[model samples]
Target: MMQINSNPILAFLVTLIFISIPLSALAAKHNNATEKLSLNQDDIHGLWIEKRKKKLAVWIEDCGNALCGRIYWMKKPLDKKGQPKLDPHNPDTKLRNRPRCGMKILSGFVKNKENHWQEGKIYNPNNGSTYSSKIELSKSGILKVRGFIGLSLFGKTLKWERPEQKLQHCG
Candidate 1:
């Protein structure tokens, strides 16, 4: 057997290589993970109906921190009696007070687990109630949204389907 001298330089090089390999791999894996959640503007654009409400349209978009959703359109502006008024004792006035055409009903949604997103709020225009909300994207392009009083078990779930694209006419 031949005697081999262990050099500090070789040991340092080996340690550096080992650390770099895993670091680079981790970076690549992170990139791939983010790519999987790549959401396009069109994917969330258009009208979305609130399952609880008969005819309400909430539009989803990308907020500064995470994804945001708002009420961009509605079937009617006034109540059945044709009066433009808001409920005085409503708890979700911040969301439902504005005109239906431009209301931010959802905000601060962060991706959770795999297909679900948490840390968001959903506001109900009917009763003016805002609750903690979670959103899940299904394979069929349907968004399952849950808004609860305290926990998810105590609230209601709404499923909104992606609406058909419409042509914009500017006259």
Candidate 2:
């Protein structure tokens, strides 16, 4: 006669369920940190220095219903051939030859709260990828820009600061 013993498997499954409950709760808490902030057009406007490189700057402007940002300046504006650097990494062949400067890297960001812009996309010219994005102005005047692929939890946050020296354009 053969007998079945399910006690060990049942105990293990129960342990997994208990462990997952806490893990799920932790994930929810982490996502809440990405919630909207209190911000306005004026706070987000002007040139901002990319955290990764201070020499690179983005000009943020008000575009009727939404806000947009473009690559306004770069430490090395020109290549060895004395020509403006181009978006060589762009996925679109037609756009690949376009100048990196003045290219709008940020788009479709609409104000979601008094301090947060949501439903936006941020383009990384280097990698030629665009991700879902949001923007928030911190109390210290730093812009907290978050870009994600699937969920806000699975994204990165970059701090952008207003340039001390203003550029000629951003209107």
Candidate 3:
């Protein structure tokens, strides 16, 4: 008859190694998911259009130490009078005559620790309303723009996509 030698210390060590292997694998998987969410901040610098309403194209670019976005083009730049659309809803009557196509609707977007553009403002020409905004680039290559009244919970997120073809900027 053969007798098997049993060591408590060896058994415990083997058990711990087996447990740690799965835990380490789980951690690696989590890290990879996090890496996919962490995108380059510079990737935001380009033209993006609203996914739902393709009426406007906003061009995001480096402005000073932060980022700013301007209205690069419009599907219908002219008003019924055949004149360039103006900001009639602007609070300042004197500034209402300004064209909407070249307006800077997004400003002061600073990249934060979470790889999102935060502490920015987005202007809505439709109502001449400015809201606190933040932007995030999703893993699916969608530019998510959130405009909030006060806090983020009271906000709406709009998806903007990078156009595959060339755009007629301001044309």
Name the top lDDT candidate.
3
Alpha carbon deviation, residue 64, candidate 3 (Å)? 0.7
Q: Which number leads on TM-score? A: 3
Ranking by TM-score: 3, 2, 1
For model 1, how does the per-residue alpha-carbon lDDT over 1-171 read when each residue is reduced to its tens digit? Answer: 422236777777778999999999999988965544343212554456655554666777788878887665555656677765344436645534545446677988888776678999976656667799998877766778889878789987888864444422111
List model 2 lDDT by residue over 5-116, tens digit each.
4577777778899999999999887765332222222468877887657767888898779999998888878889989888888889899998888999999999988778
Q: Which ten residues in a row are the worst by lDDT in model 3? A: 33-42
Model 2 segments more than 4 A misplaced: 1-42, 166-171
lDDT of 1 at 62: 84
User: Measured by TM-score, how close is model 2 to the native structure?
Assistant: 0.70
Q: What is the lDDT of every predicted structure here?
A: 0.67, 0.81, 0.86
Candidate 2 C-alpha error for residue 30, in Å:
40
TM match of model 3 to true structure: 0.74
TM-scores of the models, in the order given = 0.60, 0.70, 0.74
Better of 1 and 3 by lDDT: 3
Deviation in Å, model 3, residue 78 alpha carbon: 0.9
